[model samples]
Target: MQHSTSRWTMLAGSAAVAAAMFAFPSSAALAANATLPANDHVLRVCADPNYLPYSNRAGQGFENKVAALVAKAMGRKLEYTWASYRGHGGYSNFLAENLDARKCDVVMNLPYGDHEESYTKPYYTSSYVFITRKDTHYHIRSMNSVSMHSIKIGFESDTTPETAIKLLDLINNAVAFHVASNPQASPRELLQAVQDGKVGVMITWEPAIGDFLKDYPDLQVARVPSEEYGPGLPTVGYTYGMSMGVRKGDTALKHALDKVIAREQPEITATLAQYDVKLLPNPRHVNFPNQ
Candidate 1:
């Protein structure tokens, strides 16, 4: 999430290939208990097999459950085409290999707006949070907080949070974490640093924080607020909308997904809750371009 590469990068190979002639406006339009290659009865999902709290080969991630919910709502079978979203080069092959190659109809958990693919309206919103040990003497609600100046901070370098820290003259107090060192283990290592006293506080995106929270009972989390921004920081940008991606012009699937997302929002929220996700308000509205 902290990479310099735009997370909303374009599809490497843009193909307008449509599936069967049929297109459904919503899940109801599809027949129940249908199978693939039979009038598009299956929801082919493209996902990373090991990114937990999100997805994995074992299908234990919330995104997996969300995918099933989508398929069930559409009355179609769920079939997965596993692919790593990241690699030695970092999130480079995701769209080229999967979405562009038509490995799946939709790719889940995209940050909404401005992408090579036509993303469905956001399904949920989350934020970057400030995590600290429970025994810490104070809270860090933003970069300007009093505690932030004295504490050693840990964050993936080159992100806005790092920028904010630098502008605030706290660079000397910062500790950098490399998420790409090990996609599966990086977040854990960051959290572990906070847990083990390597850093007094850590700021991280919400999605990566939940899965490791159970192991760090002493950690306390606070959602960084939008108000945390100043001259250099336009907004704390703690909040962001997350959506699903489909072919660039696949409005058929796009609208259908938007409906399922709205209809199944309750279930989706519950899924995230099961992982102890740090829920924040905002992102119910998407910042899409002119309609």
Candidate 2:
């Protein structure tokens, strides 16, 4: 589902063209310095300001913890390049416009499993689910479950949920509700709908759901599995593996960051837990951005 932040209307291939058009020395420059610094003092990180459960300026989100882990791994202080990701094109736009501009060296909390963007390597993994009242028997553990019951499920359009429902054939049966009745809806609306019980449940990643559950005591949540995947869809639940986002051709930095993530996984997981973030069945990749 798409969030209702800025309406991200892209001109198709905008991301690719943006990359091709914005090609400059920054990508190569960072790639050259990808090696761990001898002193381990500072690692500039790009983060979203308003995205919660994942990142925020408050340094309370999972991404903040992740940044700390990376910093610790590099023996550097964590510095941030604040950006905003509020739409379909927001991520690509932020990466190209900001990170590519050399404002930051690395981007955390990106989708590692999706083909939308190339990634370094899997650092953490997670799945999506429906957050609802414990008493609600919707039992949305799979696509078939979604079809068997009459549910008014709400999600952000243009997001993973939208993509999942479209492929699952559950759209017809789902009281398919998007945050916006017309063009799109914001992330807040979906959160509100679930919190207010306007909808039986809202589809979301576990990280986001964990935060919601922490704040709201009465809600119950369930993760969908790959085995639940129906025909023509992913066999497993929507597994979101997260990795650092580096510009294309920045292989040196990507490789270095990959090693950092691999070596720091334990610390990263601990930091996330300290922030009250939950990784179901263990973090398969890293940093579930949905939260």
Candidate 3:
């Protein structure tokens, strides 16, 4: 799933194009005795002001927590550059407005392999999950599960999960939700459909799953396995790495952020766990420290 708050939209390529178009500073320029903002002592973070479980204006999201931790560790205060992401062309210019414009120094959460900017070592991995209430008795572990074709699945349109469902011939039995249909629509809407018995299951990104499951503990989550992928389902990976994003030329800042990530690995895990974030295998060989 594409990170940076919402997973429903595909903006990775657009962001990369914006980065190139903006003519952001090169690595050489960034490495030439580059330093943090003079005398500010602030960690400027770029984030979506309304996207939950990732960031919000109130600083309640897991990314907000991690950013705070990083700032505290570096003896700097936390500052925010609130950029809104409304999916597609609505507010998809975050790369140009925030990073390239120097609105903030770092984006706290971005897809690890995203080419839009320089990335620190991956901090965590997550994926889309199948969500169903416990009372439904619908055990969906993989695409091969017998219940796959029988249940009514709800998912956001134009997502990896939706593509997989189509490949499995489940689209006819699926309810497709669209972000553009209503600017306020969210994973909550899909989860509510399941709760109201409108759909038997909902497949969505893990962060939203973790957030909504807090209020509906009876809901079961099944992580989509990588081995279940087949022909015509090229976009449906079960897991993806996530990392912090910095401007392309900011190698010095990138290295410093990486060091902070390694030193604060335990705190970062704890912060994500506090928000019920479902963490996948640590690609950096870092284990979740003792709580």
Candidate 4:
């Protein structure tokens, strides 16, 4: 079953990458899909189209800036392929189509701390916050505060939400409506759940959570401090980074990408800020890594 799913995922990713490349003719061809050498004048990137605050066709998102930054640093141009990030098997599809198929050199805006995808380094760190009813006292300041009241937390599966909640031992608070399937569900779903006395919390990351609050004035998010959770669930931070997702032996490209990131960090952050994307801060550098 796993193998079959994996194969299907690969096909889906490949198709997506192909579609993206076809959509953007200006971009360079990838090694996996067509035949582009590492010495090509342009770098190919695979991104999620509908995902905002990250990458989109408008070219104003953080990931897009990162891509442009790397290109500028390397004195190369950027070509992009877009895909939809639905759920669980997403990276597999992305990897199969983009990396394995060589349609793109890097998958931008991946969660920095995620070990599953072989991340580059810690770039930006954001926090996982929840929106609860203004009237409710379910401040997500700590896990112990999560009482089994009527509070239901909306979490996107197979994401930091899953890991963050698990680390906090707040799995029981999870509301299983499947956001991936019901992409149209409003931010009000969480609010309605709380207002109707269904759930007390709706856990998600930025910038959606931030966007949700903007749209719904009544919905207030819980600003959970990182120290509120246990060690594993330490809310101290979540990272957003970019890395070159190459086939297992694609070390040469990876080395080149790392150098690009180092050189282009400043320009990337400036571009991102233009889109209202505030990257996480670090002691040495304010820019996030992976990209």
State the C-alpha lDDT per candidate: 0.68, 0.58, 0.68, 0.51
| Better model by TM-score: candidate 2 vs candidate 4 | 2
Q: Write model 1 residue lDDT over 1-291, tens digit each, in one string.
A: 323222211111111011112111234322222232423688888988887767889999888999999999999999998877655434434655566566577888666663455788877767777889998787677778998878799876545566667767898999877663355554687788988999998887767778778988989888766553455634434466668878777788889889998899888888888887756544432233344
How should the candidates be ordered by TM-score, best one leading? 1, 3, 2, 4
Worst 10 residues of 1 by lDDT: 11-20
Across 1-291, the per-residue lDDT of candidate 3 in tens digits comes to 233224444322223212223334456544542553543487888887777777788988888889999999888988898876554433235655667667678887666665567788878777767888899776888755778788888886656666677767888988887642344755577677878888888877677658767787667888876544565533335566678888888887889889999999988988888878888764332211122
Off by over 4 Å in 4: 1-35, 113-118, 146-150, 159-173, 181-198, 222-244, 271-291
TM-score of 4: 0.65
Task: Compute each candidate's TM-score over C-alphas.
Answer: 0.81, 0.72, 0.81, 0.65
Using TM-score as the yardstick, the better of models 2 and 3 is 3
Clashing pairs in 1: 49-56
What digit string (tens of lDDT, one per residue) describes model 4 on residues 43-161? 78887665555567887566777777777777788888876554334444455555556666677644333323444554444444566667666555543464533456665454444
Off by over 4 Å in 1: 1-39, 184-186, 228-233, 281-291
Off by over 4 Å in 2: 1-41, 113-118, 146-148, 167-191, 227-237, 280-291
